[model samples]
Target chain A: MVSVVPSLWGYAIAGYVMTAGAIGLYVVALHARARRARDRAAAIAGRRRTSTPP
Target chain B: MVSSLERVAGRITAPRGERILGWATLVAMAASAVMSLVVSPPDAQQGNAARLLYIHVPSAWLAYLSFAVVFVASIAYLATRRTRWDRLAAASAEVGVLFTALAIALGSLWGKPVWGTWWTWDPRITTTTILLLIYVGYLAVRRLSDSPARRARWAAVVGVVGFLDVPVSYLSVTWWRGLHQGTTIRLLGESTIAPIMQVALMTGVFAFTLLFLYLVTVRLRLGRLEDRAVAEALSPRLGQSAEALLEQEASARG
Candidate 1:
């Protein structure tokens, strides 16, 4: 009979989960950073755009 | 004529060279995983534990390679005052830090099966832990400094000086009769392991290296973009100053 105990597969599952989680975190970080930088740039350029009003 | 050396050197340092690095890295990582997992036969003695070598060795090599770049690039920046070199050093350090952490984790995991332990204060491991700490501090220094010139200057000096620990970390095994094995890549040439495994590991190392290059380039570009934003924001003041100087010259001539 095949054992369905979690201990047997736990490490493998954990390893896979960690890999997925780390990659996901990295992706999220990249996107968040890019978005923040974009917003910051937009704000900077927006102020410059409005203040000069040429 | 573009000498081969010059071409190779240019490719390594060029900003756009990262594109090549990105493709190479992906290819290497895929090939290595396949080679190590499917192609290479498991060791009779060590069995599955040997499998860990694929990720472990490459990450370790990356640690050395990253610090080496920091050492070399930092010196070049200090000598030339070019922000570009400093940026490369910074990028390499960040990538190196990632791999170093991976190596430590993989090492501990592998050790449990082979050495019956999860952690050890072995000299090599301790040295590596310290090396990781030093680089982390290097990154902190970069974050703490706000002025571009001062940041580069301080970071470059730290990168160059901090490199002294790299050799010590590498030699720790050789220096002490430690449980951790000495650097393994040197054995690549004469290793008894099958050629397929060799291909896998070499592919992985190259891939990781390329990946590092791509990442560094992107990060540096981001830094450059920020600088450009600041400069463009202040361009009006620069223009006004230049116009005032021109007006003063015109009045003096009259």
Candidate 2:
């Protein structure tokens, strides 16, 4: 059997890398944004409690 | 009152089984990568460059699938006027755009080596790009309104109409003369590719589908939380308690 062109390997590798990288980054961003929103909500609730007279 | 808040909070939290789905997606994707790169043999004509099909076809499938979800969910939201359907539609659109962008980029990458050009005005490429822009507009529609019902209504319209482009994109290669190849794989008929390549391609499709499901689930949960946060932020200005604010928002959404 004839061997595949060596240069084609780079293209294949790059395609996979880009696909995986995009997905991984998106997942990380989602988690980070969720954490930030949760913290913001907590802070807002805290301020509401502290500003109110006990 | 406490129960109502708890219920809202629970709805915003990650859906059950999301964690397991996430891990399964990761494993499946890894296997798919291995199968595509290591297991599958090179084509006689395209050589190893054909391996790009594993990622390219799957990303395209996902982009198409995501938009179909958005289309169906959008119709349901318009009919029922439910926030959940709206959220699902929005979440699906977001995921669909992500995959669409990936598909375009991967196609460009493949084009550079095979077609000897980084870009082209081929019917398939043009139509797919149009599909991407339409959903990008859908996301913009979501940001255009503060009122939940108005936002859902407007976005649902875009989501439904924007879906017309999907069929156009799928058929462009057939409908018009193009540099892109026509459909090689058929659901009702046999595929023209080798068995090993077909297996690798199928694995890629399964893996990406799982990933799409997991991401949409996370996005839906996050969307609800963000909506709640915005409602809560506006509560003080409206002179309403959090519970009352949520109730009003829920009713308004209905």
Task: Give the number of the best model, judged by TM-score.
Answer: 2
Runs of candidate 1 with Cα error greater than 4 angstroms are: A1-24, B1-23, B187-189, B230-254
All candidates: DockQ:
0.20, 0.62
The lowest-lDDT stretch of 10 consecutive residues in candidate 1 chain B is B241-250
Best by DockQ: 2
Per-residue lDDT value at B161 in model 1: 87
Evaluated on CA atoms against the true complex, candidate 2 attains a DockQ of 0.62
**lDDT tens string, model 1, B1-254?**
32574467557646567566656766776776677667876665566457677767777888899999999889977776665566678878987888788788878877776788989999988989989999999999998865566777788889988899988988888899889976555654666556777777787677666666666666655554555555545555533332233333333433
Cα misplacement distance, residue A27 of candidate 2 (Å): 0.5
The deviation in Å at residue B184 for candidate 1 is: 3.3
TM-score of 1: 0.79
Q: What is the C-alpha lDDT of each candidate?
A: 0.69, 0.84
Q: What share of the reference contacts is kept in model 1?
A: 0.05
